[model samples]
Target: MGALAQLLPLVRSARRDQDQSVLSAALQAFLDFGIKRTSMVEVARRGGLSLATLYRRFSSKSDLIQAVGLQQTREFIEGVDAAVQQQIDRDAGAEAQIVELFVAFLDGLRGNRLLDRLLDTEPEIVLPYLTTKGAPVIELGRDYLAEFVTRLQAEGKLPAYDPLPVAEMVARTALSLALTPQTVIPLDDDIAVRKYARDHVAVSFRVPVTDS
Candidate 1:
């Protein structure tokens, strides 16, 4: 009986993986051919599945887009955690470590096709997820920043401040700059943005910006 139960979960998980694969393919098709241009039949074709199968998993295109956006957000947070772990293991300086993790998070978002489409081409799909108070993605970002800042303060790397509140403010400010139309931060200008984020951290913690 226990073996049967374990096997049942594995079977359910496999089915779930298959469903996600179909959805991922549909998302790629949507990215390639805009939301309005893509159709359910086309997505199924791109996914190498039957229309019935696709519709069974995602009732509509809008639903699929939302799922992809949420998945992207989850993956992005995981990437940020990995980057933070990597930086800490290397004993990176406090400010440098924070900026590195922040940049990694931004980079992950930039590479997300669903998010890119929503941000750059379809504001209708993007605005709700970003603006909503209880949105999962926004909440994850806020929580991650708050935790990181708190850790820094606890480690004596940063001054004792209310990390959650400060991190929330910083996240909001950064999001505003990034999401604003016609305002692009070129991370490629490597030194400048790095210096900018680092300096902001220094000011926030009331620490001197060191010349490294």
Candidate 2:
């Protein structure tokens, strides 16, 4: 059998444990089956957990999904922040570093299939906190963008401008692009998505986009 087939039983056994392992299993099930197919009873059964115990841990499906979302969001923020710091420490060229960071950020976003499903199927779950709560995930992103802009501003690599508004615009723009990708009208193929991200950063810093 293939490696994945060989690992299936091991994966099941690992998930049978009653600790965070079970929760992880439940979350994975939800991601695989989606919200509509993933029910509380199914989650409990997959996790080898009792329905009562699942309820004790998570009062409802929404609560469990929220917990999973928050956990993934925190992890993503930390990973992206670390990647940014690493790129800065390497003293890579500004455009290259920005591209690397944005790609890493997009990888994180794509990995969170559950979050994507929530965005598509249940925007109500995330919209309120993303806007009104202005919680850690959003703030971390803003701070990262603001810092990148300020760095460029200090080095005179870009035009002088308030980073807050620019960061907000970039964040809002990115969010919109991610949540509602342009399907009706196709984007220009000359510039790929990664290039688009790099171009946005270059424009924000007022840097020329010519080959280095």
Candidate 3:
């Protein structure tokens, strides 16, 4: 079975913008005092709500964190989808859209307060989530990339090989690049990053099609 079959099924949370403010407050709490140090009370205080109100919404700290994660995943996917659509509207080429895949990911990740703060101050805390405990997030990325790959292959921009493995590679690499600060890839340089993505990461997903 391919990775897509192993992909986690994403369900849109019933909680809408009303609870998003609470999630944002919780995220701020995590940013201010790290995940371990942040508490439900702090989230409630930051959100300007009573502790009972907070607990009424999120049963526990664990529940709150999971909600925050689900919300973040939605935001990340939405941002990437818009970027891809913008690229297409501009009549960008296949290579350009492929470049946008990696480009849009890291670009969206840039200046993410929680992510940057966590990596800078508490690598030990977040590294595991990005690596070992990463199946949930990775599966989400895998599904998105796999869908994109299937479309590209249908358009004859990619080979007829399976899209799941290719998507997994791209997804995993994209996540790794986002989390890890040290790399020869030169992410600090936007122009260089796009060039590297177009020439390297994008190319790696496409296999040679032989005359059968």
Which candidate has the highest lDDT of all?
Answer: 3
Instruction: List the candidate numbers ranked by TM-score, top first.
Output: 3, 1, 2
Question: Candidate 3: where are CA atoms >4 Å away?
Answer: 1-14, 47-59, 88-91, 207-212
- Which residue pairs overlap in candidate 2's backbone? none
Supply the global lDDT for candidate 3.
0.72
Model 1: per-residue Cα lDDT over 86-186, one tens digit each: 75653555777777765775666556666667577877756765676224455556777778877776766667777767666666655664466344555
Cα lDDT for residue 114, candidate 3 = 72
Residue 115 lDDT (model 2): 68
Give the top-scoring candidate (TM-score): 3
* C-alpha-based local distance difference test score of model 1: 0.63
Q: lDDT (CA) for every model shown?
A: 0.63, 0.61, 0.72
**In candidate 1, which residue pairs clash?**
none
C-alpha lDDT of residue 121 in model 2: 77
Q: Which lDDT tens digits does candidate 3 get at residues 1-212?
A: 13222222322434556577798898888877898899888898888889999888777775676566656766787789898788665344457677777778888777467778878887887776667766667777888888887777777766788778877887788777778757888788879988787668766776333311
TM-score of the candidate numbered 1? 0.68
Model 2 earns a TM-score of 0.58
